[model samples]
Target: MGETFYIKNMVCNRCIASVLDIFGKEDYTVESVELGKVSATAGKKTNKSALASKLKEIGFELIDNETETLVEQIKVKLISKIKSGETEHLFQSLAEEFGKTETALSKLFSKSEGMTLEKYTINLKIEKVKEYIQLGQLNFSEIAYSLNYKNSSHLARQFKTSTGMSMTEYKNLKSWNRKTLDKIV
Candidate 1:
């Protein structure tokens, strides 16, 4: 049977590609790679220690412990939902999606990650807003609605609070202040 590994800091498509390349370079036969998981078969010559070190060098982590694996799973699920414009029913659907009660998942996430899941979700949303603003393809209202914000004002407040700059100021800045999706946490 192939082994499945949970990965940390795998919050975007680029992260997936990076992980696949890392495995490929090491000549591991990757069965599948997804948001925060990779299934692979290690040959007899495979060196797991070197693999872990390489992954860490590029800001990705291979999670083998149970608690960390669960935490990564939660993060992947939340990020996927947010990016897919499914923020409308996040709280109601999370428990069912993760096969645990909301309270249980919340407690576990908080204890392991040292932050509330709500806080993490907001950070994810704010990062997406930054991306949209940087793209210059949509206005604040469209971004707000797409990200399920109640209104532009609310989005503005959160964006300012998170990044210490208003959205307009952020968009007008000479240098970009956006963080990679994996770095949000």
Candidate 2:
């Protein structure tokens, strides 16, 4: 009932669905599930050692290192917060949940993922901004504010840096490239 297992690349909502689907079909009643772990129900035990084999058979991998596990948890939480429009509320909440300085989280995130956490976060914000632009419901200032940017110019600066073009240029580019999420799991 208390067994827990770690999964590699459990970085997004789809990854969450993937893990739950596996347990559902296998008829294993899961006690709980989170970014990097699944707790097994006592009478419904499934071997943790075998999860690696089974998970990979379905495309997820199990990560064993302690540091990678922590990094992935942070990444998943950050990604979800960004996706759900909760960016401004996350910093204090996350510092408490992880029991570490945001500086510490940023350093570990950069060390593990080969990019600054701010860069990763801005990439996601840009993606969402682009979505709003495409939807035609929000103008630049509104989009910037919704994403917690200091101002439209700041959002424009970040958008340009990440995609090598201004948000206006990106939308008007002869060819538009949709952004992809990082493989943070």
Supply candidate 1's per-residue lDDT for 98: 74
lDDT of 1 by residue, 1-185 (tens): 67897889987788889999988777789999898899998877778888899899999998989988888888888889888999997966988887889889889999997889889899999988988889999999999999988899999999899899999999999588777767766
Model 2 compared with the native: what TM-score? 0.80
**Candidate with maximal TM-score:** 1
Candidate 2, superposed: residue stretches over 4 Å from native: 25-27, 42-50, 57-59, 89-92, 173-176
Tell me the TM-score of model 1: 0.92
lDDT of 2 at 60: 75
Alpha-carbon lDDT of model 2: 0.76
Model 1 pairs in collision: none
The alpha-carbon RMSD values of the candidates against the true structure, listed in the order shown, are 1.5, 2.9
| Residue-level lDDT tens digits of model 2 in 1-185 | 45676776676677778888876655567788887688765345555556566788866777778888887777778877887778885767787889989888888988998988777777778778878877779889989888887799999988888878888887776466765554422
